[model samples]
Target chain A: MSTKDNPSESGRRNFFKLAAAGSLGALMASTPLKKVLAQVQDPEKPATNIADALKIPKTETSMPGKFPGKVVKVFDAQSVVEDKPVKTAAYQMLSDAMLQLTGAATLSEAWLMFVQPHEKIGLKLNPIGGKLLSSSHEVVQSVIEQLLEAGIPKENIVLWDRREFQLHEAGFTADAYPGIAITGTEKKDADGSYYNKEGKLYSEEMIDKDWFYFADVDGEYDDYTLPYMVNAGKYSYFTKILTQDLDKIINIPILKNAGSSITLCLKNLGYGVITNTGRLHAKLWGDTSAEVCCFPPVRDKVVLNVVDGLRGCYQGGPGANPQYICNYNTLLVGTDAVAVDRIGYDIVLKKRIEEGIQQEDSPRGRQFMEYAAQLGLGEADIEKIDLVEVIK
Target chain B: MKNTLILFLFLFAGNCFAQQPFVLRDDVLPDITSVNTRLFDKDGLWGYINGGADLYLEYGFEQVTVFDIKAGGIDYKADVYRMASPEAAFGIFSISRFKCQESARITPDDCLTPYQYIAAKGNFYFSISNSSGSPEAQVHLLAIAGNLLEQIENLSIEKPSLFNYEMLGPHLSGLKYISGQLGMQNGFVRWEPLFQQSKNYTAWIMPVKQDGSIFYVALVDFSDSADMETFMQKNGLTASNGLNQVVGNKIYTLFIKQNNRLVLTEGVIPESLRDYLEKF
Candidate 1:
């Protein structure tokens, strides 16, 4: 029945809808976008917090249900209209990629396979790479469109990242895309601190009190005293939204070469899901890239990972620089985060090796992948991964 | 592979490259003093390198003297990035080789863009981006590069003896010096996981083919023979003194410490490495 919800089959979709959406993007550029920010800011806005929501219990684990290390698909197209992500081309790439990854004959079937109609889905984006290299709005819109056609209400889907500033820098605000709840775990944008700019700690009520893990590494856990540590592994706390608000999380990470080696799904959700990530982060050298992503809270929540490799950077990144910016025009999709990252690491590693700067199997990122695989996170070896490619 | 034999002969020219240091003289570009220089220290490194500031910083970057040369009423931008040594200079230039297309017959050991010229000379890796893209600008770019290479010839770094350059079949043009974490992670050092960044070791990679780091012999120079041996002993990599210890997968990696230098060869037969080490 879910497979029968295709816009084409229902005749609900038309070309004019696309034209109107493009016009909306231009309009969003000029004005103070979505007015939903005020409503969602309340910790109790939805009335039912994560603790109560988990009791409504899901019978099934959602799409890509069991870490099916089956295959990672890559679809690339250089469709930049005046150096910007083109809507139609991006939509085509996403549709093709998702269908191939899930082996679904139709588009609507692919979406239903991921979530039930009433389930809340959170789309986590990586925006540290800034405007040009961050997650493309066009790509997000394509995903949103597919979700809408799948019978999921727009208000039920939330687009989130670690810091509000980075999300803003990535060019999406609550108002930017109306109906969708665009927000973050941190109250403000990254002010070089994990905590808010005002130095106030995030409310513990947002993190799942019982379902948390700690690396047990030596460091002062900042937000431990906030009465939220239902179990204080303190440093790494899963946000309440991750624990409660969304039933399925769609990891949308920017594909770029990182000083941390490669910032794909593993790094995006691993680091993005926790608090006091400062203890885990080390630029140029990977410190906690392994155990961070291996934690139960972050790993268990992610159902699908679609890497935004379209307009990405090759060298100086996860902090975007124009010089290293490349238009690979690719989208990599997979259920297994490590397998996807291992492939991403290889792609980025090949580029770095060509640049004569990096080598394969460096102790950091590559090792984290191996550790993830060992923990049954996903496939890390090239032999184990089945790669599907569609280039346009 | 014949490049190795040619490289063996080229190693002797290390002294030749270290001789000249002022190639950007008045003759290279008419009225060269009109070239204004902006000295960028660590704090202000971004003022010169921009996005690539941290790249140079990790390479023991000291300062960058960016010379904005005005000649024949054309603005030619030349940046002389000064690292700690010739190897650091070479390392900086090596990483910058990618993304540049349309190679000109300019610098023999450099990556040239359509409007830019890049090369390493002694302790300085320099680049010249010609805005005008005129015939006169091309001539000045070449002339300035040639003179600078000759001037800094004597300051060029010499290859460490551990590599046994004479036995090297032909892999010389693919060499660059580095000394930090970037070097260690890029096959310059064998796996230790806890590898520390240092200026004590001078690491350089010589890829086996066009673009690959997996199969290469990395020549690493330690402070002395004791230090080299101590590193081998401490890290349990001691496969020297008439013996060779091979490590790694995908590529057959061989690590041998002789004298003050450590030879890490990947993809080469361990049996042949003995004869190579004996030749040095």
Candidate 2:
């Protein structure tokens, strides 16, 4: 056993102290703690150092890319037929949406606008829902096919997420997309070990220590959470794949709800690119979703947002609950993440209202979008967005 | 006498540290392939469900044991959560279960959907799921849930005291128990603004229909008078001698606060519903 695998003596002492004070349960329970430990470094409420993220200079290709407030919504009833996605319909829908979005004469021209043959492109997908309600293979294949047709080499294109195993579980495999590199930050070896021979986490090396979202809020994780988080403290390091490997990122998130709010483009990119995200979700879910994108890695690299709504959950989601899953049969493409999410929120909210799940809109549901807009991420106000809808 | 006292203390401590049995034996369920159990406590819950842990933890989570089993040529994943209280267990169960296809034959409290079976019994809430949503898989899912339920000594599933009202019996399935903002957001979001103003309060909310109209009734119990007072003040309301009927923003609010408990009804209330609310 390596020393890195175990908590330091001081760390163990602090954990036990927190356990005795009932802070551990309170923190995990999301209960506001009144008692403050003078010696403890962790704050009662989550507070990330957004100042560091803001220091990075923004490029011309920074978020709200090419088309800022423009969102192209393409809905084909045949996109998902009887709970399954139609490959032909998916390809047609993507082609139509991209063409309309870029006003390109051809599909290749539209693809070329986002990426060049020389640049390494990354496809960030939401595969957390497994096979039941993940990003459909039809849509992913269509995106890859379009990229291939645009003269990008197969080796230059990568399909990735936070969890490698989940990406495989969702059927994003070597057999499926042979030449494209499929990878993740948190990966296990052939022997199913998340740790290397020296017992350091394989994910530990995958993180870039220099770049981190340093929050005043410290995370004290147990053994189980440590493997996923890689490290615990005030720092949440960005994955090397986002920081070092990829040049241009195309975010493909599933259209789903995380509570009242929709986890569309911003949520997927923000949470996916970093480590120690569990602490952020408790108090700063909206903040993390918005502020993490302000960093150069996410802000500058991510060029496009394509939401797979072909088969998504309208109610009980971000997780796949079969009953709540619906055939949205829709695809939303945009350069402005916030605009696409705003339009997606309206669609999901309308479904919730029509199903009698909710009577009226909750102000809290649109909070992340508002935060993202305020941070200069994109357009959050529906009135300001130029929505072009195509019904096929 | 001192030695005897020391021995008794050791026995009690040993019993306290004893593990909760989380396996389905061959005798209990025949033709089981294997059971792989994983335990999560406090912060460890983050690994189990990622961000979804917050909602469960907010409802006073203690610990959870997950069983990944291969049984009868079918893959089954079962999660058993031990919450702080029975109300906490039910609160999580209420928010998670949706559009139930039928009630599990094992217990009326269990909700059986096509791909999942969820139940809250005593201070424990558990869900068993299979990827295949076929009827064959559903049968095994219920059986696994039933066997797990039997192992739990406490089988009581108690509803809030307000449920004693006969008028709410028909809408029992729609009833939700909320503990915090996350629960408020997921279960009964319309009342999130009102609840956001206060803390240390648990609410039982339900929607009722009368004469082509829908209204919401929320029964809140605050941990202390200060919280209740703060909630009333923030929402701009005064505790009158009896039920105070306030009409604002095209919605009707009829509420009464006594000590730490408040029963409020909101939305477009008709004459008959108002009369019915007065009975409370």
Candidate 3:
């Protein structure tokens, strides 16, 4: 190994000593930030001076971020519970979130700023985890009330997810609540295939053939051509529900750790919207899942993220393992999915670590976050994220 | 020692589903209301628990005996991971550390909390958590946990005798034991790479606090002396005289060999504190 490969203990001590002395700002400002950044980033390059070692590269986050400092708003009300008929706590939480997210003087104004009368809005509800740990009905009710107050007609609003069976199993049905269109692309039948009871195939008219983005992995499932793009054939086709069906989406994802680390806004869309996700996870924690959000269907379409932290799963989740679940009773909201997911990832990771689970990093979801950032989707770095915590 | 009940369950003649070889007894806690379990093997475990289930399975976890204990209108969740062997039980147990400032001795070779508990017994590594927390709740949990432990007949690995508590100092909360790496990016204010490498080889770590200051004292035993020397040289600390060689910036490191074990320690403590060590 080269002499530059191994830095001495004095070198490390000097770095800490500089930290203690609070010369970090002077050191960071002394040199051209980018040039000094390159040397410190290099594994093989040994530290020549304490200043060079001290330099940290400021993350070049995506500009014109929707939320200030790429922040996600997290609101928790200890009062939000399952037994209550009307969620008195959820209304407070939602109102506080809207007032902060849009910086409106009132909750109605915040909702109005986002929802115009012309656009048909979709409230994407994730009910996959079912009764124990899915999006709370009371939380959704708060969203509906806000949208109505904002001047959007009841007919213009729709609450939907992947399959109607899951939606129904999650306690959402069109007939159960009149005047609100609660629907799905297809109904999951007894055999677990997507089909409408009326005998229409879900893949037929529902999936927009022209608007799909393809990953084009090894074997050809469908007879489509010229389907290769971005990051070496990490191909996928976007859901028409996220693309053509709705003009905008208000994401309601449950907080849980997927087998691949975290299943927040990114995974909710990446896996929930795509047709062929099995091919992606086969890579064993790579950037494939991250690249899915880079597509416009999720990246541009999602206007709000309200993570259902009311009851969260630290382990054995995105499934109903009630043993690993806990009640956080908080809702995390932000415009940027990357920022929102990063915070959600930390919450779950901390719980896992406390439970004595060893993880190298949030390796699977983390890289995908960086890929999203690399594509100018949103800010993935934690330092740049401005977290807004609201206690209701 | 593995949980003997696991093999004992297989020997019985009854409805195979009714009695799992390894499960907590129903009447362990006086106030126990109900019980629930989540287990992982080759197939069902994949959709179970958090990210590190694979690590436990690799450490010989045949099943994770998760118990949901309901008592006094409060619920506590306990997980008894029955590893294939006692060695596997301890290896996986390395991932957990005492989260408090100092662990109150409620059980031998264990850490306790009314809200949470971690202990390694035979081939079973047990963890208990209750969102319902209080001194009374903790007392109930300990009683429930203690009795539950008594019911399990399994082989276990003792806490390493190598750790010299007096010399290591009293900041027991700062101590950690893991056969796995600490996820440092060169993590936590850029001490990542150093902690990442130094932690996995660690048998024990203690934060020696004095004069309102804390110095991290650690004992890492490497399998090979040559590798230990390489590790010392690579970190730019080549010990010149007994344990004082890597000293710098209020940080002290000692590299020693006791037989095949390469016991290394680095911290922000005085070098004279090395006199406190006693071999396993």
Candidate 4:
């Protein structure tokens, strides 16, 4: 339903009035008020025309579907090596495939178009998997190299995640690659509070001497109340900083069969956008991971998605639970995040079936692609999408 | 048999008569005099004063009485100031006797207990006692008081904890709820970042639901009308027409769809005495 028809607005107004009155009877009556507010603020929005939103041109092969875009599958290779030579071969093959899919003249040009040079690019890397199941070093380096070749200066490109110490543990050097700089948000601010220099900080204008302003709305409604809105002194602000400065974002998600579900581009963006990533699970509405994935802050900022499938964990993931890593030697790149994730879902299903695992039995096997598609994020159907491969 | 019955009846009657005649005593209670002072007192308390002694009382609740000696022809007014409750119970009264004179200097320290006096300094503090005096119970009470007491009440205590002092101000303001979204840009001061090229565009609407209300806030990054029109057409979402005004570098469009109804009210308070309601 559209936000205009939301029942929570009046309910919230009532709640505020009752709260201001300090009346117990009013508070008791406001129970439904709270529920209605939660429902209206359910995070999910209609992803209608996402392909058009990303400026994906209409093609003859594009079929009419319930969702906004289509998912295309390219190549699925098993038993690939992780060393430099093997990784280069895999990337070259993947890059060629992406070039063909995008209809660009060269791989570099396609990469440039996908990630515009003038815009400040935030490459959100999924590093929670540590060294073993994180975004492959080869994939990250290749993208960086491609951006550098496309004339995107090193300073404008920021390789970021939540923690810098974790990146160091995973063997990433502290070198500033001329044009591209790498850092995390755990550094100290001048005011003694921690600062996330690259991402969106809590607006300083909202902070009073003791109390801080936290709005679920755009700060326009008079029904505003400060319930969970903590006083600034009472709580330390831990902000997701990278989102603030960047004009555009390229999400590099490792293809892993998450214990919770598929950890694809949507999960990557959703988790990366919020300071408290763990709180998503605590939300009462079922499948908080999927719900939070649809938030405008993360969903709107994402310009492109590139899924690393060269070596994937098909069984357990989002941090190696072991018995899940499988070499799939694939790279799925697309502007449509939902479509890219849908294809990733198919790859996971294929691996699960090959290993004699029941797709319905696994948590990661749950059909989020369908739900995401219903939300207008992308197309789950393969018949409408045109897939082209260039392998050397 | 008749004699025995008569004797039984008499015993019963005598028992009933003994239960009678319980009367509330009507003796003249101590006349409590009101003084313009900042002390707390109730009934059943008296203050003693000596002649030619200096005394001062700030205003709240204080009592004064005069004692005269006929032989010496000397009259003196004894000032009694009601101190705060020793055990921290509300409405329980205590008093301190002060000798009255023409002019006297009184500080908060003289009227309040050392801990209470320091707490009155508008700072947050907690008391830690090393002695073997009900440590667990006292610690709990101190913690409760730390959370509950206002800044004015805290001025009476001495040596309040620094951490508690820092926490007090913010804790009182409470949490604020806000709702809004990011949507279409109407204009730009400079072509930078998201607006790199002449027609670069991006915008979003976050119709935030807060405190049982909905507020529509739009964040837009493009100034081109054509781009905005295309965006509106592509998304199947309508734009708030005529909201093209730009303030500074950012453009803001605000429209309130609903008002919050939750009102805070003191149910039992009398309307005439609303000014003193915060004190409660």
Tell me how many clashing residue pairs each candidate has.
24, 1, 16, 90
Between prediction 3 and prediction 4, the one with superior TM-score is 3
Q: Local error of candidate 2 at A3, Å?
A: 34
Off by over 4 Å in 4: A1-79, A82-85, A176-179, A186-242, A282-297, A359-367, A382-392, B1-280
**When superposed on Cα atoms, how far off is each prediction in RMSD?**
15.3, 10.0, 13.7, 30.8
Q: How would you encode candidate 3's per-residue C-alpha lDDT over B168-275 as one tens digit per residue?
A: 534444444444332221012123334334532434544455877655555566667665666666677765433444434435556465753444444445545555
Candidate 4 lDDT over B127-148, as tens digits, reads 1111111324333223323322
Q: How many backbone collisions does model 2 have?
A: 1
- Which lDDT values do the candidates have, in the order given? 0.59, 0.79, 0.56, 0.39
Ordered from best to worst DockQ, the candidate numbers read 2, 1, 3, 4
Per-model TM values vs. the true structure:
0.59, 0.86, 0.61, 0.42
Name the candidate, 1 or 4, with the larger lDDT value.
1
Models sorted by lDDT, best on top: 2, 1, 3, 4
Worst 10 residues of 2 chain A by lDDT: A31-40
| Candidate 2: regions farther than 4 A off | A1-47, B1-20, B25-36, B69-75, B250-259, B268-280
DockQ of 4: 0.01
Question: Could you tell which candidate, 1 or 4, scores higher by DockQ?
Answer: 1
- Per-prediction DockQ scores? 0.05, 0.49, 0.04, 0.01
